[model samples]
Target: MKEKIKKNKERGIITMEKQRLRKNKGITLIALVITIIVLLILAGVSIAMLTGNNGILSQAQNAKKRTDIASEKEAVSLAYTTAYAKNNGEGKVTYSQMQDALDDNGTNAEASGNIIVYFPDSERYYTVKDGVVEGPFEEKPETELSAVEMFENGQNCDKQDGTCTNETHLHIGDYVNYEEPTSGEPCVIGPSQTGVENYQVYSLENNDLNWRVLGIEEENGEKRLKLVADSPVKRTGVRETEEGETITEGVGPYFDIYGAEGYLYAPDAMDAISQIFKNDDAYEARSMNINDINQALGKTTDEQIKEKNFLTMQGFIQYKESYGPFEGQWTPEDWLKQNRPTSIVSGEVSAYAYLIDNGSLPSELSGIATTVENERLRSMLFDNVEPETGKAYWLASRGVYALSGDSYASFGSGVVTSEDGITVAGVGDYAFNSNGYEFGRSGYAAVRPVVILNSDVLIEKIEDQPDSWQ
Candidate 1:
C-alpha cells in the first residue's frame, strides 16, 4: 500500500514508488483571474454609455424639441394662408396691414415692415415678421385690446388713416366721432354718410328723430359730445296777443302745460313734434323732444331710447337764468304765484324766458346767443346760419300776451325772439287762441334741436362714406 503513492521526482533519484507529479493547479487560478478582469472592464463601459451626453435622456429631449417646433411652424403657415385668402384681393400682406387687422377689427395700415403678429387670446399667438413664420408663441402678452378699443384708437384725425380724420368739411348732418352715449335732442335718423344700416339709430316710442353731432366737450378729463338738430323744425305760434301782458300762457311760471318742464308731462308740442306711444293708451301721445329722451336715458325698461345708449342729459347750468340783451327782473314760480294775474309788470323781462333764442347750449350759446331758464328743455340755434347754407335762421325769446282779466287764464299769446344776429326756436310760437283754449295758436317758425351725449360711446366715421348734403 505504501508503494502505491507515486510522486514525480524531477531530476532527482527515483524512489521505490514514483511520486506522481502534482499537476500545477495555478493555471486554473490564473484563468479565473483573467475572467474577473474582463468582467470589470465591461461594467465600466456600460456606466459610461448610460451617462454620456448622447445618452437616452438627451435623445428624448431632442425628440420633444423637434415635435414642438414642427407644430409651431405648421400653425404659423396656416394663419398666413387663411389671412391671405380673405385679404380682399391684396396679393401680399404687408407688415403694417397685417398688424392693423390684428390690432383692430378694421384695418387700413400700410407700412413696409415684414412682420405681422396677431395675439388671438391670452394663450394663443403668432408672429409674422421679416417674412418668417416665427412662432405660434407658447406664451402670450400681458395686456390685450378689447373689441371696442381698436375702434376708438385715433386722435382728432386731421388726415384720413381709414380710422379717424380731421374732417375739415363736416356738413350739417355729417356724423362725427362721439366716444360716449349722447343726450338732448337726437338727429333725424336716415340715409347719410354714416349709414343707418351700420349703426343703430335711437328712437322714441317707435318713430325716429334727427340726432346729429353738435361738438365735443371735456368732462372730468374725458370728452363729451354736444348735439343739436340739423335743421329748424317746422312749427307755428305768434309773438303777442290782443295787448301786451307779462303773465301769459306761452310764457313760463308755467301755469299752463306749455311750460318748459311740462314738455314731457304731455305732448305739449303736439302741433310741433307729437307722436303716439302705442303701449300706453292713456298717454297715447308724447313729445319727441330732448327732454323726453333725457328723462328716459337710464331706465331699466326696454324702450328704444334706453337701448340706443345714445346720450346722457347735460346737468351743468352754472349761469343765472336771466334775460338776454335787455336787463330786467321777472321772478319764477312762488313769486309769480304771489303776484297774481297782473303781478308781472309789462316792462319786467325774464332772462330765463329769453333763453328760447339760444340756438345751441354754447361753449357759450352762439347764433341768437340767448338764454333759457328751462331745467328740462335746452334752446338751440344754428348760430344764425343755416346748417347747410350758412343762412341765418329765426329763434324765440319772450312770448307776448294780452291781459284780458280772463280768470280762466285764457288769453292770446305768442313767442318772439330778440332782433339781433340770430335766434333759435320753434318756427311758430306755441300759444293760446282767443277762445282761451291752449291750441288757440298761430304763426310758423323753425324748430332747432339740441342734445347731450353720455361719455364712453364711440361715433366713428366710416371710410369711403361721403356726407349727405342737406
Candidate 2:
C-alpha cells in the first residue's frame, strides 16, 4: 500500500511541472513578438527620416548650398564697396582695382578686359567701364539680339490679345515723340506775302506728328539713331509781284546773289537745325541734307541705277546730273564745319532707281511704275511735301545748274519739289536781273529738320495714339 501511494505522488508532481513549463513558454513567445514589432516601427521611421522628401539629409544639404550662395554674394558686395571707396566715390572701378578689392575681401577673381570673373564660377562676372563698376553680370543669352532687333522687340505696342496692327516694332519711318525745346526756338520763315516780321515767327502748333525715324547713322564709331520731321518747320514759297509775275522769296534770292557757296552755308539751313533743340550737347538737330536721302535708299550705286533705267523711267535724263554728290563721291567730313560745296551737280541715279525697284515712289510723283503702298515709305519720302501747293522742301545742300541751256552759270539750292504733279529731287533757284537779263532757275521750298541722337540716348515708349520717344 505504501509503495502505491508514493508512485501516485510522483505522477502528480510531474504533471504540475509540465503546466509551469508550458506557461513560461507562452510568455516568452508573446515577448518575442512585441520586440519584433517595435524593431520594425523603428526601422521604418529611420528610413523616412533619412531618404524621404524633406528628409534631414536633404535639408542639411540645402542649408549648406544656401550658406555658400549667401557667402558669395556678400563677398561680391564687400568687394564692390571697397573698390568704389578706393575710386574716390567714382561710379567706375578698374578691373585691376576690382581684383585687388576682391582679394582684400578674401575672394579670388580674374580680370578680363572690362569684365571681372569669379574664380569659382566662370558664369559670374561684372562689367567695368573707365574704373566704374556696372554691377554683377549674368550669363548672356546664347543669341544676342542686334540693335535693329532691340528696336523691333522693344516697341510699345499693346499685345493683350497677341495681335498688334500698329507696328509693334519701332523702325525707320516710325513716329517718335520728344519733349518740346524750351530754348533755342526755331524761326519759321513764311512766304514773303506774310511780311518779313511774320517770317521770324515760331509756332509750337506745327510739331505734332513731326518726329519720324530718318534711319541709322554712324557717329563716333557707333551706330546712332536719326530722327526727321514729317514737314518743314518754316514755309518758303513764291509771292506774286505787282505785275502779276511770281518770284522766289525767303532764302531763294540768297542762292542767286551769293551763288551755290552761300546757299550751302546759308543761315536758313544752319539756323533752322540749331534752333530746334535747347542747345543740349547730347542732342544734335539739323536741317535735312541730300546725304540723308541717299543714305536712306541703301546708298545706291550708279551701275545699279543705270541697269534699272532710273533716268529713263523718271523722264529725268536731261536733268540726270542735276543732284550733287553722286554715289561713291566726296561726303562732307564735318557738315557743320564745311563752308564750301563738297560736290558739283552730279547724278545720284541709285536713289531714284532704288525707289522704282522697291516700288516706293509716289504714283503721281514717280514715273509709270507702282505707287508706294507702304505707309512707312510714304512718310520717309513724301511726308515733307505740300503736294497741293507744289512747294519743295530745302536740303542742306547746294548745286550749280544751267539756265535754259545758257553759258551763264546759275546757282541752285538743293530741294525736293513737286512740279506738274511729279516729284522733283533737284536744286532751287530764282531769276536774277543780272546784266538786265532775266536768267536763273526758279524754285520755292522750306526747311525740314533732322535730329542726330546721342549714342546713350534712351527711347522711351508712351501709350498715346502716337507713341513718344525721348
Candidate 3:
C-alpha cells in the first residue's frame, strides 16, 4: 500500500510521491549451489565405500580367498594320500617320507590360507608366499639328474617345472663353439640354448687380462671380431690350418679376461650378427692408426686405423701411446712377398711370449708344462674345456710362430705367421732354416676376441666394485 499527498495549487501539487521497501527472502543462488555440491560429495563417499578396491562388495566378488584355500587343502590331501598308499596298506602312515613327493612340483596349487604341516621326516615342502608359487625351498637339488631334467641335451625350458638355469659367464680357457658337442651341432649348453650371449673378455691388466686386438690380419680367410654384423663369436666356422688340418673352431661365447671385452653372441643370431669380423690386431697400445705410419718401429699408425675403423659402439676409445713389436719374428720381405699384413702394430711381448706367460694351460698340461717353448707356442697351445658345452674351446693364441729375423729391420722383428704353419711352409726353406720358425700349420681354432670398453662405459657391477682392478 502507498500513501499520497495532494497539492493545493499548481506550484505545490507538482510533487506528491509514494515509496515502499520490500524484505529480501529465500536462499540466494550461491547458497543453492553450495547445497547441491554438499549432496554430491556425500553420494560419492557412499558409492566409494560400496565398490572401491577394499570395498565389502569387491571382496565378496573376488572368490580367490575361498578357492585358494580349497585348492591348497586338496593338494595337501593328495600328498597325504600318496604317502599313505606307499605304506602298502599295512604300516602306520607318516608324512615324513612324503617330503620329496610334496616338493615344489607337487604342492603349489595357487591356493591360500591352507596351512602346511611338514612332517619331521619330510625334508622338503612347498609354500605359496606373497602370491608367488614356490616350493622345494627346503633342500638342494640332486646332482645326479639326467641332462633332460637339467635343461640340457635338447630339453625345452618350458618343459621343465623349474626354469632353464640362467646361463652364467664363461671364464677364460673355455673352448666352446656353436658346433662343438657334435660336429655341425650347437653344444648341449652353449650359445645355442643358453640365453647368455655376451662373454666378458680381458687380458692380464696388472697381471689380469687387458684389452687388445692382436692385429688386423686375415686368418682362415675370415675377419676377426669387429663392430659390424655377423660377430665372430656367433659364427659356425671351421679353423683350417696351413698344414691342411681342419679343427673345431667358430665363434661362441669366449672370455678374454685380460681385454675387458663383452660379446652378445647367441645361437639364434649366430649367422646374422651385426658386428663384422674385420681382422686381428695385436698391439697392446698404439696411436690411432689414422696417424702417420712409422716404418722403423713398424707402427701402422695409418694402416691400422683404416682396418679397425669398423669399430662401432666401442668407438669411445681415445688415443694411447705406442708400445712394442720387439722385432724380427716375421720378415717384412715375407709380408711383402705374400702381399698382406698391410699394418703391423707391436705388443710388449711376442705372441709366443704372451702365450707362454698368459695363455690358460690345457687341462692335460696344467701340471706337466708351465710354459710351452716359443716355437712350440703353436703346437703346444692346447684347447681348454668348457664344462657347459662339454667340449674344448679355442684360445686367441693361434698356433703360429713369431718370426725372429734380425735382418728385415723392423718388419721382420716379432712377425708371427698370419694364417698357417708356424713357419713359412710356402715361402720356402728360407722360412725355417734362415728365418727360424716352427710347427707346420695343423688346424683352425676358436679365438677369444677382445675389445676394451671405454673407461666411461658405465655398468652396475663396475660401479659396485671400486677396487675392481686392484
lDDT of each: 0.32, 0.48, 0.27
| Runs off by more than 4 Å, candidate 3 | 1-410, 413-470
lDDT of 2 by residue, 240-309 (tens): 4558675554433121123222343443534454355422322467777667765654435555334433
lDDT for residue 367 in candidate 2, whole number 0-100: 48
The sequence of per-residue lDDT tens digits that candidate 1 reaches over residues 56-175 is: 566677787667556645555554555555665444443433444444443222212234344433243455543367655555433232112222342233432233344333222334
Q: Candidate 3's error at 161, in angstroms?
A: 32
Which is superior by lDDT, 1 or 3? Answer: 1
The top-ranked prediction according to TM-score is 2
* Model 3 per-residue lDDT tens digits across residues 18-59: 111111123455567777787788777768867888876777
Q: What's model 2's TM-score?
A: 0.48
For residue 94, what is the lDDT in candidate 3? 28
Displacement of the residue 247 alpha carbon in candidate 3, Å = 25
